[model samples]
Target: MQTIWLTEAEWFAILRIGLGLWWLESWRHKDKKDWFAGGGIRWASGIADKHRWPFVRRGFDLVVKPRPRLMAYIVAYAELALGLGLVVGFLTPIALTASLVLSLIYLVLMIHDWAEQGQNLMMALISAVGLFGASWRSWALDDTFGLFLQ
Candidate 1:
């Protein structure tokens, strides 16, 4: 068996780029015009209906419930901020944390509504947390100057 060694810097860079791109890709996919085929509202409403956390779900529904067009815009913009923040490494720790939090929320929603896909969402949430350390440095400007974890 052959062995390959990578320094902390290398490992950090790899994880940062990989996870950043993952976030960016997710945001891009969700931003597509026909992403939900005009069903985004129904889909969000359905998830709201199945939620076990009443307060949180109700809050989500209130924000995403009134007008779906507005909901879509809010969702898309939130994702865009998350994605760009991750990719740019401007606020690496905060970005990664937000990603993890959002992933966990989605995981719960998926589990409540689509049990079969719960595992996938769970895995994503786990991966997001796992990559947190790496997400702190490397490709980020924070790494370049030491502003990240402070």
Candidate 2:
């Protein structure tokens, strides 16, 4: 069999696109009514209620409960923006960092669910890899446009 090797840039591109699509698909499937004002809040509250971390529980109570609609909109739009940024290879470092943060938050909030929490952890790790690789400029719009340099 022939050996197949991928360059660091190619690997980063794949990770970026994959993670972007994951977020994009998640946002696409959400219904505004349910997510912003109805079932989604209830589901999230249930999970928050079960969260073992007192800080996370308090955060949920202080922020999510007080302004769930605003939070929902923020989450949805952030997901969309991050997904688009990754897919288009724009502001890649920022997108990756945001992905990592969001993933960690999910992992912490959903600590009771091993499967979901594991996925969140994996996503966080992937984001870390993408960030540390610093290959965002290799095939990205940011490189083309000379934006978000670091």
Candidate 3:
């Protein structure tokens, strides 16, 4: 924690902010109209339906299929919300944890898909680093407002 132009906390903050940007990019690149119209869910449904994992199939059917529209909105907006919260250092802990969980869910659902797994694993790892390092303590709204300061 001693040999850099930026301090340790600042480095952590950069990581946190970068992850936020990644989430934002994920949200931004989506076809919002198609997603809102159920295309995204439909695509996921197709994958889930043919998934080799029984649990994934069951979980998707149980949690998402019944409420496709709601789930679609939730997934789409959740990324946007996570990005905004993390980028601004507001509710960083909650945002990191939620993003970690979301990343895990994606990893599980996309098991055997190496490309997807790599991205999800990296996202989850970054979330863990930010959470454990208390990255919000620097360059964050949480720091300014004295939230989650220890």
Candidate 4:
């Protein structure tokens, strides 16, 4: 009997596509009024309140609270762009890096919430693996187009 195991590249490709679809779906479900208007501020404030780290709380209050609309737009568009990049395996490393950064931010802000923290931690791990394994070069536009080759 022969057992076949998927290669790391294959696993990473699956992960990339899955994560991309998750982000895309999340974006698709968002309501503009809730994401871009006062709702964003309220959500940020709730997260800041939940954060035990004073630095993170202060950062959210000082930075995020001041420009809720801008932050909302940045987050919404970034998710869409990252989703597209990851789904098409284009610039995978860059998309993964961005995912990692966003995951870390969420982890910090939601540390007090075990469920959210765990989810963000998992995302960060996935991003790290994809970035370090050079999965972008496998089954990706970067490979076909000869872009970002190390």
Candidate 5:
């Protein structure tokens, strides 16, 4: 067989695996304790507090307001679900959609927090990666069914 460069879908699948691993590692790091005890939820709430924009902060506050502990649980679970799904390639469309939504929400909050916020750029990039990373082709279960976007 002749050498062949990776297809777009293949590249996306590779990206999916890497990103999924990154999220999984993050979830594992948070699994050591309850979210309220300086874990994932607390981390998410703390970041939310930094948002200075009224509507944005308000939105985050509504999700985890006055309850960092609860927020912790939600964040941890969400991360776990999204991370695991992406890593395992069980549900590429759903996993990628969830990742994109979460990242987009974070982007909005960050930009609202600071008129000159720089975090938004990073979030935007991550969202784009989820959208185009072609992650449904590689290590995912979607690949087994021949359901890649190709």
Candidate 6:
């Protein structure tokens, strides 16, 4: 293989780290006070209410609407945690999988919004690539701690 400045593993690690930074950026841009006060969840609920899919509306009302505050906290903190985990490679596979799931959920919920769907699609793709590449093996703490390495 033609090598660059870094080995293949290192490059993959960089990709993983970049994705982690994206998650961090997502978390950083949120207004925590308003999000914690249920503003974010309320906004999502409003979208769900108007969604063309009946399943989206019913599922949200059943799972999120009844607990707006809790869901808000979950969504906000989950981003932070996933970002930290991925950046440090503390739990790369878990972080990548969780991010994939979250991205898929976001993709589905915002299917009507073409603009936001792009980010969701990219996140999901990156998560899958990083997970399959074992990106943590190079610059990740997972390697140092010997976590999930056969």
Candidate 1 lDDT score relative to the true structure: 0.64
lDDT measured at residue 56 in model 4 versus the true structure, 0 to 100: 90
Which 10 consecutive positions of candidate 1 have the poorest summed lDDT? 118-127
How far out, in Å, is residue 35 in model 3? 0.6
lDDT of 4 by residue, 14-107 (tens): 7887878877876788887788876866787888967778899889889888888888998888889888988899988889999889889878
**TM match of model 2 to true structure:** 0.90
Look at candidate 5 and give me any clashing residue pairs.
Answer: 12-133, 12-134, 12-135, 13-134, 41-72, 52-113, 89-140, 89-141
| Per-residue lDDT over 30-63 for candidate 3, one digit per residue giving the tens place of the 0 to 100 score | 9999999899999989989999989899999999
- Of the two candidates 2 and 6, the one with more favorable lDDT, higher being better, is 6
Which digits, one per residue and each the tens of the lDDT, describe model 6 over residues 36-141? 9999998998899999999999999999999999998899989999999999998899999999999999999999989899899999999999999999888889
* Candidate 2 C-alpha lDDT tens digits along 25-138: 878999877887756767888989888888988999998888877888888888899889888888899899999999998888888888797678888988898888765756
Residue 60 in candidate 4, Cα distance off native in Å:
0.8
Question: Against the hidden reference, what TM-scores do the models get?
Answer: 0.71, 0.90, 0.96, 0.89, 0.71, 0.96
Query: In candidate 1, which residue pairs get closer than 3 Å at backbone N, Cα or C atoms, i.e. clash?
Result: none
Which residues of candidate 4, in runs, are more than 4 Å off?
1-6
Clashing pairs in 2: none
Instruction: Report lDDT (Cα) of residue 79, candidate 5.
Output: 72
- How many clashing residue pairs appear in each of the predictions shown? 0, 0, 0, 0, 8, 0
What C-alpha lDDT, on a 0 to 100 scale, does residue 50 get in candidate 2?
81
Segments in model 5 whose C-alpha atoms lie over 4 Å from true places = 1-4, 38-50, 111-127, 130-134, 146-150
Cα lDDT for residue 67, candidate 2: 82
